[model samples]
Target: MTTPREHVRNAAGFALVWVAAKAAHRVRFRTMGSVPRTGPVILVANHLTMTDPLAVARVAIGHRRFPHFLAMQEVFGWPGVGALARATGQIPVARGSASAADALESASERLDQGQLVALYPEGRLTTEPDQMPGPARTGAARLALRHPEAPVIPVGTWGPKQGNGHIWHRHTACLSVGAPVDLSPWAGRSDEAAAREVTDAIMAAIRAEIAQAKQMWHAR
Candidate 1:
């Protein structure tokens, strides 16, 4: 039941946390393309670690924008994070719901109001830095097509925000955003069989961008 008004509130709250986190951690977010400054937009990014949101938030503030994260219900279940998620307008979805209808409705409403929605199509963090993004879901594609006029930005993030033990364990991390992909052509094809085509294309584009970032990160 996240409405456009909810996302606006979430954006405001995220801004405060982003400011504190970035300033305290000295983490920097870099962008490879001009982030759409406004409109019903979607930011599709690779999941590196739990701190992925921090990186995205920093970049958003740096770019002078606010983006709402489509988070998992588990994160919101935590007492503190749950409270934060509710206050900031972050969308929390169940791990395996009957249909992603609730999430879609919430996202559609936000997009209709011309707000940016950030989603991780992979459904979870990447254990292997180079593993091809697990077959992505079509939610993001559908969301993009819902707001065809808005930008469906494909983004790739590499490295770690601080720890270097694994996904959450890198001394430093970098983010790279690729050109936006428009999915208006596949908007109405909601059937699973038909949606797979759209999902594949988006996943391919995201993987391509992640590959580019992976190479750059390893080279350094």
Candidate 2:
């Protein structure tokens, strides 16, 4: 059950996100597929820039689901930002540390609580010259395999790259939400090989969504 304090926090968090997102870019969100109103959800998206999380959050908020992101541990060290992150339940990932796996466990716990967990399976921003999504890091796949009942939704975003050099300039960002991927074929498989296959399937779905999002970006 959500407490009154939690509801207040969520409202404040969503308001902050809206202000920051609108101040940075003119975002156009399109939901090509449905996001389950209630349940555990794994939202996987392609990472383009550091601002990508804001875009994804905008989409999730539109669907009435407040996303808890798995962000780098360094972000949790910032003064006010860190405090807010902790309060809003964002998972911190300590990459290259022994405690790295702990983030996944925390994510699993959130899933068990029926919360929406969002992650960039690529692990980092895409380095592709064309800005296409890179390889998956298996974390998202592992979560999916661990919780087979949760739907893995693919989200595509474009236009944030245009604001990289001109942070003050507001550019148009286009985001498209895709349907949940069918992980039935790899259900109950936690092996590395299975994880890689599942990640590949999930990335393919994300790429398809990106392709559509790109078209929308250029047309606007």
Candidate 3:
């Protein structure tokens, strides 16, 4: 359960991030379907750019859900950013290290506590020249298998590219949130094959949402 103090801290963090994100980009957000207002949920999204977390957070905050993101470990080492990440309860992922599994464990605990946990199954910013989502790692699928009760929601973001060196130039960003994925078929299955299948389905859902977000961005 979130303490009153933590709630206040999270709210402050959200406000700061929202304002900063707005100043950096013109963000357009939409919810294609309803996201649960309460309960534990696992949000999976395409990894577009380093700033994609901010776009996703905007959507989560709009629904009154304070998101605890599983972010890259290096981000936790940055000066002021690291302090805020820890203060807001963000989980750091030590990619390619044995300690990487610790992030999933921490995310599971957050879900058990009925908090929203957001992850990018892609694991890193997409190298795709077109900015489409790439193949996903199985951490998200494994987490879903462990907590079948928690809904897995797919989110898509567009307009944030990897090589944009213009930090001062405001860019247009679009976020689209999809409904909870149906995991009943994979229920009670925890094999490697099951994880692969689940991950593929989750990635597919995210890809579809990204297409929708891209259309929204173009229409804007």
Candidate 4:
């Protein structure tokens, strides 16, 4: 169930991202319907820029779901943004500290509550010149195992990184969300080896979608 404040915050966040996206680029979302409308879901995506959460959140809202992301603790300490993040129930990741574990635990609880939990398995935005997602962190895999009932949907985002904050220059942000990664193959196993397999499969799905998005972008 959602509260009035949650609805208000989500609307505000969507509006903020929409306005920003309009100034920065023309945004397009594809295959967003693939995500389950109601239930526990783990949204795994490639991180391209700081604006990724906004873009992903926008897509989630469009598909009738609210995203609870694992964001940096420092971001939750930001002025107005921090308050909004808290209001919307975003988890804060305190890198290099026990808070990170707390964040993961919190995320698991959110999943148990049947909410959508968005995570960038790469852990951080990529610095690669090509802007591809870096290696996947083990947290995502472990999380998936802990809640095997929740499907991990791989979403690929391209173009949001191009505009930065240059309002005068318009770019295009293309997001493509694919079907959930199949985990049935490792159903009974929650061991490290199984987690590693699941992790590779999750990353592979993300990479496939990212590659497809890039091709689509370049073809345009």
Better candidate number, 1 or 2, judged by lDDT? 2
RMSD for each of the candidates: 4.0, 1.6, 1.4, 2.5
* Residue 144 lDDT (model 3): 98
Q: How high is each candidate's TM-score?
A: 0.80, 0.94, 0.95, 0.87
lDDT of 2 by residue, 54-137 (tens): 778888888988999999998899887788778778999999899999999999999999999999998888888888986679
Clashing pairs in 3: none
Candidate 1 pairs with clashing backbones? 10-88, 163-169, 163-170, 164-169, 164-170, 165-169
Model 2: lowest-lDDT 10 consecutive positions: 161-170
Give the best candidate by lDDT. Answer: 2
Alpha carbon deviation, residue 4, candidate 3 (Å)? 2.8
Q: Write the candidate numbers in order of decreasing lDDT.
A: 2, 3, 4, 1
Error of 2 at 205 (Å): 0.4
Model 2 stretches astray by more than 4 angstroms: 162-164
Error of 3 at 50 (Å): 0.9
lDDT of 4 at 137: 78
Worst 10 residues of 1 by lDDT: 161-170
Report the Cα lDDT for residue 21, model 4: 44
RMSD of 4: 2.5
* Model 4 spans > 4 angstroms off: 1-25, 162-170
